[model samples]
Target: MKNDLERAFEEARRRDAIELEWLGASIQGRPTFAEAELLDRRGIPSCHVWKIPRNEAPVHLTAIDALRRWQAGACAMCSASPRRLLVDHCHRTGLVRGLLCTSCNTAEGLQSAPSFVAYRERPPAVILGVEEMYGSPWGEEIAPSDASPEERTQRNAAHVDAAEGLFAGITDRFRPECADG
Candidate 1:
């Protein structure tokens, strides 16, 4: 009974051969060429062509499924095979702490906390209204000039204030509850 299901899963994986990673960002997205090469060299075992993680890696599931799993508060660390069941960072940062199991994260922590920490902290975390941010999606953008310190500080302050105002009014845009009563 189970063998047939396992066989089918493997067959599907083989069919999806072009993509080595389906669950998260591809190797190219790793911070630097050195980083990508490092991950490649280390050999991400669970992402092997033939073997699937013992407990399924929820890479391709729809939002509803992911949400359900998240709301249920499933253990961030794998309950079954701790090593394979790591809570992989969606962004591989400490602040985001989205996917991986506890053990894998701890293992990586020994290597460098910043790399892991960056995963948990979402990029462009600054919320400027529901639609826009003062900073670009990648965060800080250099204007390509050696502007004076005073000028730079003033520009930054204005940007931050604009972003705050944008986000602040976001709540009002969605639910205008104050007027009813």
Candidate 2:
């Protein structure tokens, strides 16, 4: 039997094909060079492609579906518009991490791969709250731009603690043992 992730990948590919095919068809007869280039570059197979570190590249549909359900079509990194988002995965394990916009994806690619992998493995619970503000604890006034270094550090530490608490809550409630009760 196929595993849950495999099943999700299959279902997402089937659904995303329709959208991709539409994109392909829309550029079929355009005279602009950009349009034709888009068609040639994307084709059908490449349009939804998500490359892993390995030779096999997965389609973008599964990650897209997960994001749609969990994040209301917002980019995980910047919470920007969901347009042209791509799947971010671990190259070593090919694990689907999250949906990121092109810029965010590039930014992430520059960071340490292990950090991204760790974040993806046990995603923070705050990720579930897409509408909530993500970043530092001090929203606007806690630390002004000119705040002393010590003040900023304190605020950052507090934010980290709060984030850890949120993740702990999610892990405690959703752990396998807890689920059986």
Candidate 3:
């Protein structure tokens, strides 16, 4: 029993040492085995390559690959410009998801973390009235008393029509069949 326990401890230490060495090399900008494979096959840029621990050696795609795949100058989330797009992945699995703008990335990360969920579960200590922050921006443009029910309905319908028209004009590149003529 003592000999078995000693062997297991030694094995664990050896594994930890190897992992630490790998991490050090990674931080020092050395490519992993999987990354090297990608470099040879795809000629992916060194700056855009990264390794993730998996049973089978895995590497995330290059920036050029992402650009080719997504084929737009906008984020996968929020439809914002890709000026500051970040590589997003599953925190638990290290699987690449897609590129996201900074705001969407931060929001997604926060929503998935356990502490953020727990904090949301607890009741708020204080709540502020909507009036305190909102400050009636629509007060000058529109007034409820000025418009009758029928007029209000017409205004709403017009707004909905405008929105639909805007969406219709935007091309859906993902679906070739649905591409604009």
Candidate 4:
């Protein structure tokens, strides 16, 4: 009996509730640098720390936790179990690629780097069904491998821009000087 507008409002409210829950869980589950170091020193693998109680977590968070566990807490590229791993995502499509160490993440930003080429050839998100869980931004028909050179260049440029934007948004709270204290 609900009108279209009423159904739309209900859907929007449902989505907002999900987003708020996700944000709260993310903030609560994330550890500070010092906390991560302490966990590391205690001979504990911090990989599972990204998760909250499964019943309370959103589907996306649970999916990420599953993916992280599948990767065995190591950098997807170098297999280094760094205290903190960055979530690598496609800048053009906003789909998560995989977890990476700082060095690999930085290297991947370069268009000519082997990491970038590898990513373009086989995006982890697409391969591992992460994109399916997250929902694809675009259809697979326009995948990077099938794109023209100009399209690839534009995508690479977008990636660099997105990475720079992310780095620029980091506040002093996350800087090494502040983290050390």
Candidate 5:
């Protein structure tokens, strides 16, 4: 297990360095620039992200931490990764909450902008915060919610599009095999 510990330490260092790099990049164009300055201003320690619920801080890296959270049955959104996760937040409010990966968080951002015509349209469920059987970060069952007819219709349309794409890809992948049949 010593080797495993060594690997974990190395990975932690790498993640820390990379996170710092990203932090630097994010603040580079701002008035005050410098990675160390950003981290100091944000009060980020070496181990975890800081100050925001969805800002990817408080990421669990060690197997022990992951195992403990899993044992306790954590929310799936948080369990999807091990190294670290970038949580998202409400940019308008700037509240230190909205834990999600970079994508989900960004999707929220893209979806949240009211001034942007494209993002102004939001799904009813997201606007309502209605809980439903949506996939969690961890591989656990989530009971979504009852949707309105319109929402159901939209969901069906999306499913159909996705299934069609999947089938097309599969058919393309197996075209040579199909020639024999």
Candidate 6:
């Protein structure tokens, strides 16, 4: 029999594929490249994609799903039990940070407040060993309590830099505006 973790992983993979497909179709019908670029510039993910980390085990979609379950389907920041929780990840590393309800997620993206920074630095998944069960997909778990102030500042800066580069590769794919002949 599959364990809860295994089952969650399987389900996450399935859901991830479905979401990607839906996003692909939805984006094809809209001029969202500009919007995506804007969001990326602000360190807010316009869309979620699963990326394999260099020299590390990939964090599967299951981790996010498992985290959602672990958090009891509530916003990690405000503890509001919303019907659907959005996966909050590091825009730079694509690491699964935590799950948040829509309100908190939106506010965090806009403000980048200290609470969100603290939450990401030591996500509950890393603290409670939920990530370890999934092969520590975050590479090395840096407990917020253990990281020096400098390290945290540097990490946050890296996230900003990476977000600026996130949509760089896709710029060429967007169609340019047409001019009247």
lDDT of 2 by residue, 43-115 (tens): 3111122111221112443433534434434455444554676666543232355666686578676855443
Leading candidate by lDDT: 4
Superposition-based RMSD of candidate 2 using all C-alpha atoms, in angstroms:
18.1
- List where candidate 5 sits over 4 angstroms from the true fold: 25-181
- The whole-model C-alpha lDDT of candidate 1 against the native structure comes to 0.36
Candidate 3, clashing residue pairs?
none
Measured on C-alpha atoms, candidate 3 has an lDDT of 0.41
C-alpha lDDT values of all predictions: 0.36, 0.46, 0.41, 0.56, 0.36, 0.52
Candidate 3, residues 14-133, lDDT tens digits: the string is 766654543334324445445544553453322233332222111232333433233234444334555666655433222244555686568766664432332222211111000111
Q: Name the candidate, 4 or 5, with the larger TM-score value.
A: 4
Decide which is better by TM-score, 5 or 6. 6
Ranking by TM-score: 4, 6, 2, 3, 5, 1
In angstroms, the error of model 5 at 162 is 19
RMSD of each: 16.3, 18.1, 21.1, 12.1, 19.5, 14.9
Q: Which scores better on lDDT, 3 or 6? A: 6
TM-score of each: 0.22, 0.31, 0.26, 0.40, 0.23, 0.39
Error in Å for residue 177 of model 6: 19
Q: lDDT tens digits, residues 1-181, model 4?
A: 9999999999878866775654444324445555655654553323334433233334544446645644546665555678998877665544567777897688777746444565555554444444522322343322255566678567667656765787775765677876773
* Model 1 Cα lDDT, one tens digit per residue, 6-119: 999987787455233432232222233344334434542222211122233245543333322331232222222232333332221111223344654566556444433333
The regions of model 4 sitting more than 4 angstroms off are: 1-62, 132-181
Worst 10 residues of 3 by lDDT: 125-134
Find the 10 residues in a row with the least total lDDT in model 4: 132-141
Where does model 2 exceed 4 Å of error? 1-64, 112-121, 124-181
